[model samples]
Target: MTAPPTAPATSNAVGRRVSWQTGVSILVMVCAVYLARRHWPVIESGAARLAVADRGWLLVATAATAATWVCSALAQQGAVARPLPARRLVAVQFAASAANHLLPAGLGAGAVNLRFLTRCGLPVGRSATALAVKATAGTVVRGFLIAVLALACPGVIHPPHVPAVAVAVAVAVVGVGVVLLKGPLRRALRAVLADVRAVHELPARAAALWGGSLAFASLHAAVVIAVTQALDLPLPPAQVALAYLAASSAAVLLPTPGGLGALDAALALALTLAGAPGSAAASAVLGYRLLTVWLPLLPGLLALGVLIRRRVV
Candidate 1:
């Protein structure tokens, strides 16, 4: 038989692994801090705006911001039939939010949730598919809301004027690309279609998937509206809500972590376009970002550390 492994060598290996992980974590945190510093001017402007906001309204916005994690948990649960522990799901989401800001797009959040789901007994493929399902539902619901809102507020939601030739060319390019990639695309489509059918077979799961997605997007917009009201911005609630939807939809095209720079710019632009003064619009966007992203960031990071140490995520 081969010689048994040495205890000392195993210990050393484990120690090195932990040290490497710790170093990587520290680097991510440093990156987060550097990015935050770069946005100090926006943060300062938002804080100034917050100083004059109505305290009661601001409190309401804070409460709504806190509820986003609950919405996330519900959406995740709806994505799969496996019953995840409710408290743990919420906690994972809280930690994932911080992790989400550390990486581009949503890779951080997706990784965190995938691990949690796998630990909860899902196979890796199922976990990934669950994430895709939740994301698909959220996108569909948000698009539906945009369509409805645009129809409701015709005056504020003007369609962009793309040249007919450009549209035709883009359509032709996309069609050709799809045709060229039919084999892989067809297989992927089949897998997604199977998962969709399986998921919707359970009425409650189907409802949760669609309903939770809608609630998450709507609540996010509500948070922005509440911030505008707190700042006493002279825009109708519907207009503010529509602007939020449009801006966030457009921001999704960018790959920023938590939509950092892209979202800030879009929010400010949308608010300004909706008739708010430039300063007030900037302040409103900043306040909303402050509540949703920055304030909870540190706490979320701490929670992520705790979860990692406990091996719960």
Candidate 2:
């Protein structure tokens, strides 16, 4: 009799929690879809027509963006310093990209990475730290390379309101650099290394990590330029590269899960100011988002279901 009452209460509690979680996911999805639609009018006006004229370029850009996943996986392999299978690394990268779009801030993305690696045979500490290093390295390399390009091609990178955002980017890079270069960072890392020595020692060749990161950065930069051309926007390749790089780097700072609407806004706005008509820029960015994010979501959802049903998570 007492057990019967407890079962009802427990089931109700689970139902309420699931309801709340589902509600949050739906709310976020709606807002994102709405913002994307708002930008549709711009493209409808002329952007679509312009992009259709040079579909090949857009295809190239889309390909480049897709290739960034492979580059990311290679970077992770370097950071992990273990002989991880290439297939597994790619799986983690692709899955993490999808998870990032849906999860809060970066926790879900990071958690997916951790889970993927650990399940692949790495110990918990090594897996988590490798993920941290890989993520941070990606951020650093992308921002640093973009800053260099922006400086070289000022006209392209300094779109409308770009000066203010560029300043912020510079500050963020410097701040992270300072933390990393300062003695405190080394000390803290050493402490972590000492504790995790049994799991895996942090790699000594910092250059290798940066090299892998650079590859990831460079390939994605190429994609941005490709997208610019594909849209038939009259922007210079150098300028488009700079704009995409800047928008993308700034997007990393956004607290929203996977940068979502925030990233879209940054990319579209930056492109618009770079002389690509608003519609052209918005459509290209929208297309990129759809391909890079939404397209993979279905597969990711299946993976999530499998993982959950298999008790993998």
Pick the TM-score winner.
1
* Candidate 1 stretches greater than 4 Å from native: 1-13
Write model 2 residue lDDT over 1-313, tens digit each, in one string. Answer: 4544687888999888667656644554564465456645643544444446467876776677678778777777767655677765676677667667666678866887787678778888777777767767777787787778778776666434658788999999999998778896776576445433522344543544667788877876676677666666788777777777788777767778778778789988888887888877877676666556655555654454445343344
lDDT of 1: 0.86
lDDT of 1 at 289: 90
lDDT of 1 by residue, 162-226 (tens): 99999999999999999999998887777677778988998888888888888888888999999
Poorly placed runs, candidate 2 (over 4 Å):
1-53, 155-188, 191-208, 304-313
Q: Which ten residues in a row have the lowest lDDT in candidate 2?
A: 196-205
TM-score of each: 0.91, 0.68
Q: What TM-score number comes out for model 2?
A: 0.68
